[model samples]
Target: MATFPQVDFLKEAGLKADRILVPSDADFVARQASYWSCGARSLRPACIVQPRSAREVAAAVRALVSARVPFAVRSGGHTAWASANTIGADGVTIDLGYMDWVRLPSDEEGTGKTVNLGPGNQWGRVYSELALHGLTVAGGREGNVGVAGLILGGGMAFFTGRYGLACDNIVEYEVVLADGRIVSARKDGDHANLFRALKGGSGNFGIVTNFRMRTLPLPPVWAGMTIHPKEAIPDAIRALKDFTDDMWSDPDFKDIVVIGALIQIAGVEQAPAYKKWLEMPTITTTCKMTTIPQLTMDYSQAKDYHNTWFTATFKNDVRIVAKAAELHDQLVKTLKAFIPDGDFVTQCLFQPFPRLFGQHSAAAGGNMLNIERQSHDGLLWLAVAQVRTPEQERFAYTLVQDWVHAVRQFAAIIGGNLEWTYLNYADRSQDPLTNYGLENILFMKDVAAKYDPEQVFQTLCSGGFKVSNVKLPN
Candidate 1:
């Protein structure tokens, strides 16, 4: 095992002694070994540095860069890929869990309120905290997801139909650049370009220490999950398409449909479609007129299993969705036959990415997703599988890869294939940044060069998708 060369330097510097944990320390061993998703739990870093503030993070960055040692920054440890948030054997891990802070500002001018959040905070805590003040921000549907990774990678939320993505709600970002400089990027600030790049650019630019997001009033929401048997897939597909097609006119309806061994529909219940879907032969779990915090709390899934996610985007066509359902059924059978001993379950989810979502973002400051450039409203497809062990992961990966390819082919056949991909749900094997469209990719590269001229983030970060690998158009 390789050692972190800057461990001693970081300790000798102003960093607190207790904050730096070596592999020998029990706390370090536990934090290093634990991950929200099992796929990254196997990675072991040489040392773990928990920074309590952005200044400490900057100090750690300076020491690591001076010593030329590789390091990975982890916010919530929710990424499912190995080494995506966890460091390899030779690297150091900057765990920002201690920086979890959420507060409402005392001074503000507008009709709405803005909440300040720490990157280390989880969406569950943020939503819960803000709900006390009768406010909520656009955030991940799943509560356990971290604020930093999701916002940086273009987040999707139930409120995305009303507001845009989670990133679109960000008013300011306090970031630590490659040169160990801490700067604030706001829409009207000098670092505006960097601000836009950070919207969907992943971890390639810099480490965001803090996020200040605009919050909406906490409205009473009616939401829940409905389970239908496999026989309902065709009807479910048609229903979903009809709902999404109508979303342009009806912006209040938000839904996420999952097709697999069973069909699951989870979303806002106020939509008439929800009532109609509930009428089908199904097991319904209903939550009516609740706050955002309570809704997310109710829908939180278990994180104990090894998870894999792959995603694709296509036009909102019922034909394509039906084809995807067939592929999902076939993939489940193949997984059972290949890995009978593994505890594996598959999920194929379709969510509306209506043109209205993009229009909302455009109304706010634009983002790197460039959804406005797309010609039509679409559905974002995610193929997810979970297993219990490392050995099972291999079989799960192969199964998911094949399923994604089949879905892509189906979309192409229907002339509905979309170049855009939702980065938050994409697997490591997929190139989501390149699919952001050629112009956005080029703009992101320019921003990377401008903010990190030494290519420190591009070369040294070594986690998440890097802008350097984006392919240029011919």
Candidate 2:
């Protein structure tokens, strides 16, 4: 017998039966299975609430908070972390995937500089819709990443070189407060503190329903992947060294080398910056002039894997990159010994993170990433291992942990370590909030208390990087 009171309370709170799903419901099973991570899919939420509008989300929040039920807010449910979006049978999941709408501003809405996005939207659909008007926003680089998670984590976008992070470009957030009050948090508004806190502070303040984001003109881009052979690693590394900024390099763990790219040089088919990489040999090259939406579709991944990911930041030194690759080899060896075949993919990606990005953020209402503190260019390094089965997931977790530790130690030895740990790629075990610095931490805490007096989001709303978990003064 399902004894979870959340279902009844949700119904009593005016949410339609169709909007709520229990373990007994077939749609509930399908909804749970829809999460990108098999680990998340395995969990059993007592009921999953599919809120189609802000008012519906508010009602759910009110019911769940009043009843003292632990709940989680899920947007797109793309993360591989088990508890990130899904909860145990004791809780409910506020799956916002149905609220996936995008709209350009009418004359009555604010300046045409911004567009409204639903929290449930995935970047690919968002990009495709926006591209219809020859426009886009500084959103997620990967198409499948949820708009909410990416923006809340201080998103790294395709146009980060010219603009800043996805968070930096947010003009306003229509957030449902802990007390079920719907409010708009914007730079020019009365709730300005909450506005900044929600940027990089993550899903601790409120459940955002609509994201009003600054839009940019999307032009044709010269982009795509270029796969390198195993023997060309040294040469590829050289080319990367010479390049100012390129697509994130994802060399496969199998050691059959690959350098997949989705880089864009706006308004031109070819840029001199990529000359070094273009000169190198490769197995496959998809580099061509294409739209951002088309390029993003090419980068979407299959959701059938048990995944473990960890990240760290370091100086943009070739030694650190080389050391990371060496340690990745060790990790791959250990993982193969444990799993011994089947489907497994590992990546050691180093994305370009320049310090000036912070300046760009500051110019546009600012974000909490705090990477601007670094006066030089850096690399946001991500180590990912996706495999089959829970057993493989556990083993891969340990292996990836060791690899990240080894890489950090090597960075320390070479004095190549940096402070910022981007929340988007961060593992659940990591504390990316503290990396935002003391000022930002204090600012977020104050905002959390002011907006959520009872600390509903901090205490009851489970999942995501919580501001309550930090040791800083509240």
Candidate 3:
């Protein structure tokens, strides 16, 4: 197979030898193995380029464009889907793990309202650093989630109810465009169009190096994972529904493990807002007074396993929730039969996607999600399956596909169906960009065309859902 000969273009760009890697290098194996999913870890790229800063990223982009080589950009390598953050030997992978830096507002031009984050910084490190300064940003609830992909794909944060999503909180982005120019995109900046598109636009426009995000004063949270037995699922669903309704309601919905309820009210052992879930019979409770960084670390999942995820949106309805529970039970039974041995874990989560959060996004300069257009308070369902073998992975894929279809079909029957999916939790088989609504899609496409006239990201840098309704090249 063609290998290093094709990677000479990056070397010809005058990149330091240490920044480029071939299969022969020991570091290449380590980098490949570092991905969160075994499927992504197994894809062997022709070469991997590690750029330290926006300028270095710009140089790599220009070289790839000049050579007309297919490429992919990765920050945290957290996406579990194959080729989402990787490429095969036919392409090169731009590994951005080296660009992880957090510049506090004081460290920047004294914009205390915002903090600058390098795309490579994981939420764990970002929160840890920001916590030291008594500040934080609306970011991924999982510590291991990368800084770039989450915001670019429309992140839902612990503070989403109060501050909106991570994308909504982004004040500016320092991006490396297709032409190799490193430009800053802000709501009122010259690249304002690009700025709005970058909010939930995924990787369609350019490689983002730095995310200047609005910061908030750090607050200790009353949050943690509360694991419940299958019997208590009804209580859990009722709690979720009530939580989404923002009012106290009768508890009656029951089936999988329920694991979250974080409130910003500090110094309180239990916020009344979370009394229902807290009252449920639990196997365990990590719920307590804690800071953002600690909460994220506590909730982060184990990586390096073969993982699959699927998601859908629906208005909060007890019947729909019950339908999902039934489907999940069947999926689990199928998985149990499929995997009699080795590591096998699965989760079906339903988080609140309140319309207020969408309205907040619109108020915060708007985003590609257009969630503000939502007419009802909703729940975003995420189905995650992790297996030990490729065969199990395939089986799990088909099983979840059926599960999603059944749930959507059932929701449609009950008038609870919604045409949206959370991009970050989506598997490759799902098309989240199209679900973002046609208006948002068209806006993102126009911005991509304006900022990247060559369509390099569309045609070469392959990964994630494309805003133009076209699938990413394998």
Candidate 4:
């Protein structure tokens, strides 16, 4: 219903009329309606701009700034937050779906047979394309996740123990800054500081157009899922803790254990211990050696419901896991009693964050996550609430917040509390950037100020976590 003043400016700046879609266009309506989360789908941007190249993105950015209109950039549109990658009424949205391109570079010496990825490409497509070459990159564990948003938010992968977080594996980034400058940022290049900040910095500095990441051999991996009844939760918690404790000795093992209404352990391994562990007293699914693309695709089915996520981190203590599992049961009971007919489901996942993950990041030019500073092995906990309607979504949000608070309090009581929060799994209310500690927060602020002096990203591009709110230490 609102007017978009920037439409004329964008057209005059060399953006073709066919590239811009207004509300009347069926394509624009379809794109706005199809989001991974219901909250993002409810927003209505004035117009959508589909830029096919970085130059077009630069022109759009310049036009939007000159017109002084609010805008948001969307890659895969997977973020759960309401307005994260989508814009509200009276704003313009720069959708990068048309820019989805994946290729291998000709100069493989300096870049080391790396894969060039567009921000618009999903992890599923990237893996499928690279799998043809017998190669893979450390990326999102879920195939449907977008390349740009996940990398910007510090991506976690099944190969994190072996290769590190997805952002750490990136060798170069082609970014379009707030002032319309296109630049390549690398570790040893002129924008080295910007390069480090972009790792786990959450789109605060610039809009990343392309990512060149180091590829690893795509050998067959032993991967599968193991499901257990509700009564087996305590055993699952104990096993997870034991696995985290032993990961220091054997970094080849990677698994994600969910302890909630039902217990499931999905993992990939190369050691014999994995097979022995699979033989434990529980119902196990088919475990076989498979390719990375197949393994990721197995878990890529999109949930047809409203989803919300909140996260926490704690030391790898069996007590913490047990207590969280107990709390999860109570939370589910309360939700069922309040919203009896609502199709609300809760998922609590515990992922291992061994010291090896940090070591890998350190080896590959340090990132803003600063996971290396953690002295002990830990677990990153993600609590997701899925509902069928708006009313259920409201209740789910409150219940998830209470659940996170109770877990943090219990951890503090046991002296096992941790300060870090994984950015990719964080909710809107949680400040994952500030949780990176005072030093990293200050460094991010400096990078944001240096590259974007006018704070265009902090102010105009008002999606995701912003560095402007990070406070320095006294």
Superposed Cα RMSD, model 3: 3.6
**Model 3, residue 241: displacement in angstroms?**
1.2
Write model 3 residue lDDT over 357-417, tens digit each, in one string.
8877888878888788899888888888888778888889889888989999988888898
Worst 10 residues of 2 by lDDT: 249-258
Every candidate's CA RMSD? 2.7, 3.5, 3.6, 2.7
Q: Backbone clashes per model, in order?
A: 0, 1, 4, 0
Q: What Cα-based lDDT does every candidate model obtain?
A: 0.81, 0.81, 0.82, 0.82
Model 4 over residues 15-73: C-alpha lDDT tens digits? 99999998888999888877778878878888899999999999999989888889998
In model 2, state the lDDT of residue 95: 92
Off by over 4 Å in 3: 1-3, 105-111, 247-267, 470-474
RMSD in angstroms, candidate 1? Answer: 2.7
lDDT of 2 by residue, 1-474 (tens): 756688899999999989998888889888878788888888788899999999999999999999999998899788879888778878999999999999877853644578999999999999999888778888886688899988998887777766777888888899999889999988889888888888888898899999999888777677777887767776766665545233333211001112646365374554556666677776888878777787677777777899888999887778888888888888888887887764699988776666667777887777777877777667778899999899889989988998999989989998888977888788999999988888888888888888898998877888788877889745
Candidates 2 and 3 compared: the better one by lDDT is 3
lDDT of residue 93 for candidate 1: 85
Candidate 1: Cα lDDT at 356: 89
Note the residue pairs that clash in candidate 2: 225-261
Q: TM-score each candidate.
A: 0.94, 0.94, 0.94, 0.94
Model 1 quality (TM-score): 0.94
Question: Candidate 4, 286: how far from true, in Å?
Answer: 3.2
TM-score of 3: 0.94
Pairs clashing within candidate 1 = none
